[model samples]
Target chain A: MPRTSDGRERLIEAGVELFSQRPYGSIGVAELCTRAGVNKGSFYYFFASKEALALAVIDRHWTWQKGVWAGILDGSGSLLDRLRGLFDATAQMQVDAVTGTGWVAGCLFGNLALEVSSQNEPVRLRLQEIFDEQIAMIASRLASAVESGELQSVADVDGAAKAIVAQLEGLVLFAKVFNDPSQLDALWQNSLALLGLAPARA
Target chain B: MPRTSDGRERLIEAGVELFSQRPYGSIGVAELCTRAGVNKGSFYYFFASKEALALAVIDRHWTWQKGVWAGILDGSGSLLDRLRGLFDATAQMQVDAVTGTGWVAGCLFGNLALEVSSQNEPVRLRLQEIFDEQIAMIASRLASAVESGELQSVADVDGAAKAIVAQLEGLVLFAKVFNDPSQLDALWQNSLALLGLAPARA
Candidate 1:
């Protein structure tokens, strides 16, 4: 038999899965508890309410994603390599043959941003901050490229960085809806071309 | 004392407002019916079920948007003018005043594409088709520009078109989350620059 702490961890795990799979509002505490294989008492012991559990799940997701990005950006590789690594890693997580079936699940942040952010003020502000941080991180990378003379010095580094991230987000949306990884490939190619990093072909 | 037919339109009107304001799952059928000022029987009479009503609302949204695009594309104007006109129209709809409220209700298809598509096959397929049609329309416009030689001949028209639409969608997502229309302005300017059109000076 699992300990009480194990049950709490299971509840958080189930919440993440459910929130990712469906709209947060659609899933109930009872269903989440059932999925976690824990009783209501255990659920209450771990979190104040379903909303608190959701907040915890979101915090965990943000932390994990930040770690992934940090690992990629901190890698001993070219900037282009770091960008590609980020895309490839995200594509793998989002495009699973078993769960994906015929449809891509899109980015968890992107999905939640669309669904919950408008009505949920806290979530909206948090997502905005997260996006700003992401843009800044990408901008820093682009600035490095500019300093290295890989990219034009006159290039609108901030604008270009924003465009790259925007295009990536768009690619995620298209890939999810179209269920085609090639859309992401095109996005990567076009972005590289825009950045003057794509290899020239005869 | 309104006619029964009025009830149907009323329900749809309420649906558009509520669904666009929040997630589909967050809005209850009972609340929707009350907002429409119609009983459950009238609601059922107009639509088979809640899902059916949602489909109807989606169809209505698609039809209205197609009309807007048609008006923009079919106008007797230069491609640049048309593009600017489209951006201006969108900005007008999205910009908020001192009160900080505007038409930045977000895209219904985008919201649903994120939340419902993964779980609902019917909605997914329908949204997918809508997205494909949107991409096709933009591609056709770019094809015209390519023929006119306004854009570089070597440019990949289809890819450019997809990227433009992707940026627009991403811009909308950002606008919704941040409740700021300035992001759309950046997107519009960057898009025009990408297309080699002179961006309107701020």
Candidate 2:
């Protein structure tokens, strides 16, 4: 079994699992403590309140996603390949994570954004920051493609990047709702086609 | 102001607001009663429990959405025009509803699907049924287009319909996150383009 000596780490792991299962507001401190295998005192010692623990969970997700973006952006390939790689990697990660949990609960950030964006300003702002960062990353990559003369000058880099993000996020939601991996495949092909880069089918 | 004579209508209206603002599990019966301005007895008289109230809310939303679908399906115009009209109408409804609510809460069924799909089988099944109905409606429309030679038979009607539904729901989630209406415009145009329909801008 996996183990953690630090109360903060334990709390975060428990928070991710529970929050992904249900909304953060529905999770109580007692249940969190029990899941983390820590007493209430230890939980309090690590986080001041349930909201704080939820924030830590969001931070953990952000950190992991940033690492994912880094991989996609750093790969030495055509811009379209890199973009397709991002979607493929996301599909694999989602399948692995959901399979391990024995249920497909969808993207945690997307799920939380739907539930709390209107109700909590702090959470909403944080989610926006993450989304903005993602958009900028895609924009930067596309801008580089434009600078290299690989893409048309009138390609509308910002617009294309935003659409790409929207479509990718949209496809993830579809995958979750339908519980089908082929939906992701269809989306992957459509996205690449939108970018004018789908591979020839055999 | 609009008015309802019975307690059940009030409870459902309150539920539409509260449940959309947050997850069903997070909102309590007392809070819903307070928001609806009805007593616990009245709430119970109308519905047996919170879950029953949630089911009622879902049923109401499904009923209302069916009306929207009928408007598009029954319209006399080119298939492309009818599809664009559907998106245009939906966008207007979203803007009007957001202004009336003074907040940017998204679709209640979507919020519920994300929150309860993994943990609650009944809710998941209900959501799946609604989704299936939506796909069927779109597929039937596309079939008409195929008959008229507006779209090629090479097009997978079911796949295209599912993609459109995914785009619409995804667009709503993105719109909520960005707090912008322009995202809906992008979704509207791109989704039509994918369907081989005339672009919304055109």
Candidate 3:
């Protein structure tokens, strides 16, 4: 069992699990407190509102997510192989999560984006910032790919990066819909096509 | 102004608008009734529960949406051109909605899928059915394209179709994030790559 000294950490963990797996608006402060194993007073002491907790959750998730991105994306390998590895790593993570939780929980950021981007502007902008940062990271890698002769030079590297992000996010949604992580396998291969490259020999 | 006679139609319309624009759990039956200009009694008189009304809204949107699909997808032209037209038409529809409603309302089925698929089984299955139907439609068109020598023969037509659906849904989510419909354009061009085809010369 994990120690629960930090009320803020507990709330953010609970927020990530509950908000990621279920609808955001349906989650109440009481249920969140119960899940976190922290009382309402502790919850109030840590955060101003549920929305505030959500921002903290996003920040925490992004910090971990950025590390994952750097490991697969920023490490040494052919760029295409690295991108493919990222998708495989992502699907495996989802599989491991299903083994633990008994449900297919898609990308937390994406699930939230679809659910509340229109309704919540602050959350929406935060999500957009995260997406933009990810896109820029991807764009930089693609630019590197162009330099290394791995991917063909493209006029719009940023545009291609955005497409890759969209496709990966879309594949994650499909995985949730089918309740099977393997759906991601077939879809992610198409990302190569976005870069004008043939599918890697699998 | 559109004339509103039927209580059920009004409820369904309101459901389509409200649920599509916002999170599912946040919108209550009272607000739905108020938006539809029908009293609570009439709401229950027409439907058994909010989920049932969601089903009606899905059915109604699919009905109207199929017409739009037919207009763009069923017309006589190169199948590739038709596919491109569907994307343009979809983006235009989003633009028109933004002009009219001041929000980038995305695909209603997709919005609901992200919000309720994990929480609601029946709704999830219903959405899965709609997605399967759309995939089949696209697969059939792809089959036609293969027959006409427009597209290379592929082993998994259905899988490719699902990728297109996923990409388009993903692009719409990005559009909502940026509150700009143009995010769709860059991402959607990659759909051609899904079919192993180059972009059509415009």
Candidate 4:
């Protein structure tokens, strides 16, 4: 049996899979242990409690997602193209998920934000920090866009960034509710419009 | 003790309270029974299972919400003013909730759409139907806006309406996450901009 740190890795892997596919409240640690192929005792040996494990899972998931967003947002291209790339990446991920799982698993941060934020204070506070970090990154990119003249100046850049992130999350929720990944199709245009951007030069 | 239909009403009322405050999977029928002041037998008499009761709760919630939306959207006012009225009502309700409970409980439909949409098929389908109804109503109002020349015609009226609803839900999610009711303040402007409307005539 995997012991200690190895057991922790396997448990978090299982958690990301199960939690992303279903609501946090619906999933129990027993299923997580079973899925991870670890015993219940091993599960507790690694984490303090289910909510503790959830906090860990949030950290793990955000690390992976931030890398993905970085690859899209931080890569070489025009700012508009890069932002569009981020939307494309999001849409492609949804497409892949629907192709593989027949369901669009929305963003996990957003999942927890709506589902458990009110019930779990620690998790909600962590999620708030993550959201603030994300909005700041997006605000930096928006500031770059304004500096490069790709977009006009926004009144409140962070506020606009928050709106963009919120809309992206909302579209993902729409995709999940409708079970149609194509619901993400309008993200690039809508996001640009939300930021008051002009049509990007081809 | 409430009997028959009265018991059902009480159970649904309790469901709306608890589920909106917490989550569906975290809430149990026994607790629901306790909250409703009814017995487990009476609860089982109305709902075959907790999920069934959730379905009833969704129905009841939507009926009440649709009335609220109608009062804002269908009542006498300009389309822009009516739209602004909808946002105002939403913010006021969140303010009221935060003041009453110190927690900003987001939209129940939106909460369930994220939490249970993947795990429960019936509830997801019902939510999809409810969202379609909402988007259609918003689209009709958008159409009226185009006819009245309050705004230019949108290429995709339904899509624009969906965007508006998505942003509204997003703002509510932001509110819940930040534990700040002011997060809903941007809905009026963001939504109008989404619909391709000029600054609303003050």
C-alpha lDDT (0 to 100) for residue B153 of candidate 3: 36
Question: For each candidate, what TM-score against the reference?
Answer: 0.89, 0.86, 0.93, 0.95
Which has the higher lDDT value, candidate number 1 or candidate number 3?
A: 3
Segments of candidate 4 deviating more than 4 angstroms: A198-202, B198-202
Give candidate 4's error at residue A60 in angstroms: 1.1
* Candidate 1 lDDT over residue span B1-202, tens digit each: 3448989888888887788777898888899999999988788888887788888788888898898887997687877678767777766666643134443677788888888876777877888889878878877887787788765432666666676778877888888778876777776655654453432121
**Lowest summed-lDDT stretch of 10 residues in model 4 chain B?**
B193-202
> Against the true structure, what is every candidate's RMSD?
3.3, 4.2, 3.3, 2.6
Q: For candidate 3 chain B, which ten residues in a row score worst on lDDT?
A: B193-202
State the weakest 10-residue window (summed lDDT) of model 1 chain B.
Answer: B193-202
In terms of TM-score, the best-performing candidate is 4
Better of 1 and 3 by TM-score: 3
lDDT string, candidate 4, A79-131, tens digits: 87888888888888888887888889888889899998888999999999998
Candidate 3 off by > 4 Å: A1-5, A199-202, B1-5, B153-155, B199-202
Q: Rank the candidates by TM-score, best first.
A: 4, 3, 1, 2
Instruction: Report the error of model 2 at residue A47, Å.
Output: 3.3
**Candidate 3 C-alpha error for residue A83, in Å:** 1.3
**lDDT, candidate 1, A1-202, per-residue tens:** 3447888888888987888777787899999999999988888888888878877787788888889988997787788788888878877776573255556767777888888876677777788888888888878887887698765622666666677777778878887676666667766664654454432110
Clashes by residue pair, model 1? none
Instruction: Give residue A199's error in model 2 in angstroms.
Output: 13
- TM-score, cand. 3 vs. native: 0.93
True contacts kept of 4: 0.52
DockQ, each predicted model: 0.44, 0.37, 0.49, 0.49
TM-score of chain B of each: 0.86, 0.87, 0.92, 0.94
